[model samples]
Target: MMSPGSRPLIPGSFLKIMFNQAFPGRPGVYWFLQGRKVIYVGKAKNLSRRLKSYPRQAGFDPKTKLLLAAADHLRWQGLDSEIEAILTEARLIKLYQPHFNLILKDDKTPVYLTITKAVYPRILITRQTGTFGPFSSTRTLRQILERLRHIFPYCDQPAGSRPCFYYHLGLCPGACIGVISRETYAKNITDIQLFFQNKKKRLVASLKKEMLNFAKAQKYEPAQAVQKQLEALSYFWQARVMSLELPRLSQDQIQLELNQLFGFRVNRIETYDISNLSGTNPTGAMVVATHGRPDKAQYRLFNIRSLATPNDPAMMAEMISRRLKHSEWAKPDLIIVDGGRTQIKAVKKLIPADIMVVGLAKKPDRLVGVNKPLDLNTAAARLLIQLRDEAHRFGRRQHLRLRSKTLFI
Candidate 1:
């Protein structure tokens, strides 16, 4: 994607190098800084993959593009899980008040309704277990529960002799007075869970039925209450979505798409390309794509070691052997070798038979493998082509860097 009237903060080889150094492939919060002052804060499940796509942002909002264009340095802190990343991001944004982080400005932690497994079932707003929603909302979240309480009255306070706060407010079904039975209370909690899960179709249908039943029985007041509940649900849903514009594809969603197209579950893809002029200053570059996204952090370069002759096959095999020796580096789902039958034959022996390998022929532009050749037009084919292209670019860059260094020395 191209952005009009703006440019990337760090483009080209410098951008690739910065992504590797600043955003290691992990769940983390990254800060975009310009001369020591932080400008943006973003959280990602895979920092390397996300950062690599910044310069190529297709539909980035104006504010986001501006942040990237203004930033001079990148900083990040790794987290354990997506959940942890979310929580940390919220905290970081609040602390820094970063100009680009428009969300989490309110001092409010996302309100979640927790239904504890108890005799009377205590429903409390918290960020603890059995809770639902870190759902982004400034005002509508509390209004939803308040309006919902009229139709499905449950308690958010401890049962006591005196009526609890919500009970007195006419928002609870007197859980403090033991008016709600366990079986019935569980059903109410289930409905709440359904609402939180965004199963609004069933919830809305059920609510509509109750509203109609009340209307028919001449229970006008209760029916009016139910009508209000429906309105609240619809309003809350609309408001929550309107809080943010349509989001970009998340890391999980990207992986899901890749998994679907690749004919198997693919989390990692590795591509290799060899660059040299008749075997002098030969180098093989490895580029990694995690979850269908390029991850510059794992990209590597190899100098030809064992091969003295100008044999591409031998050079590729040597690079593969060295890469495979580092068991700590995460393995790949598929490997793209930038050559045809001869290259595949040389390297296929080193790779396990179970692993998928493909060779791309420049002359025919055909994907060669054990299976039928695929045109470089399909999504999967396009992905392989992208990997191959990136590997070639990286290898050439590294080769030039080596050449420049030798000349200077």
Candidate 2:
């Protein structure tokens, strides 16, 4: 239970030990126990940080406060990624029916992703029973389906002669018009099944085998298409992790917090990160967030030209310099660099004094340039970190793409 004094129920040393044993920085689900009964269940993208932040969260909901008061002990199970964490959290909540998972337990509120039992299965978001999930976040589940549909197209429309809107966009396999056969459509459904089951490794292996067989048969076009799919899948998880934020933070709440933190209304935020492997194919990414959410249309990437070594600060400076030259681009209220004081120092001198700049340092994640005290537990900090991570993932993918191209050359 939460102590009457300042001490938390889970000791810092215990959390450290658990993390060390489970693998540090792993994402997973955690449960709160009141004696023998499980009272609450939650998922975290980073277990170590999430566990620590709970005690610092000033804006916790009423349910959270109630759970903390009753929870005598805590336990967790770490997983590979955020996707696994969400799925596992849902399964555990279903099994335990935890008292505090009130919104998740409601059949009408949370989304259920179903593959309708039909000749050509229609992927759907419904409140009824589902094959894949009773996913807690409706918006996230919708976005997941949209992303996956582009990779493995399937029909979501009613069976008819007319092709659906997605069919015209090449996001549906044309099940309505018989452009895809039952056997081939079944394969697509199988791939989706594997994906929802968190069997990405198996799905990838199968695709590889199929590609190999296609190459052996001299079906070069099909093999190349499969290769592209493989590359997309390679970067999919990293990109997905950036987009999926559990409980889905509000843009208004984040901006309000930032307004207080900076003493200025923050409407546009730009975050930068440099990615490289052994100083080869170094790339830099700039991601923007307007009104407290990522604006992907404004995202930009740079291939490091000025530096030939792993000088992140220099690369970051170069990226900023180029970005500043674009007068048409909307000016940012805040700029977040993914490093320490050196990174901030590198780019700060180049930018206008009117624009606020800060760095998000790791090991112990904290803001570098800001004079005000930072509370990592706040939604404002989380938004900044998310944008930084998005930039990192974007830059890394661009780096990998360059490296892969060089290999073929």
Q: Please name the candidate that would achieve the greatest TM-score relative to the true structure.
A: 2
Candidates' RMSD to native: 27.6, 15.8
For each candidate, give its TM-score against the true structure.
Answer: 0.38, 0.53
Q: Write the per-residue lDDT of candidate 1 for residues 196-220, one digit (tens) a residue.
A: 5546679899888988999999999
lDDT of each: 0.67, 0.75
Model 2, 88-206: lDDT tens per residue?
A: 77677667877777743544565677887788888888764566656778777876676576567888774678988666445687888888889889888988888887777899999
The candidate maximizing lDDT is 2
Over 4 Å off, model 1: 1-262, 372-377
Task: Give the count of colliding residue pairs in each prediction.
Answer: 0, 1
Clashes of 1: 0
Q: Against the true structure, candidate 2 has what lDDT?
A: 0.75
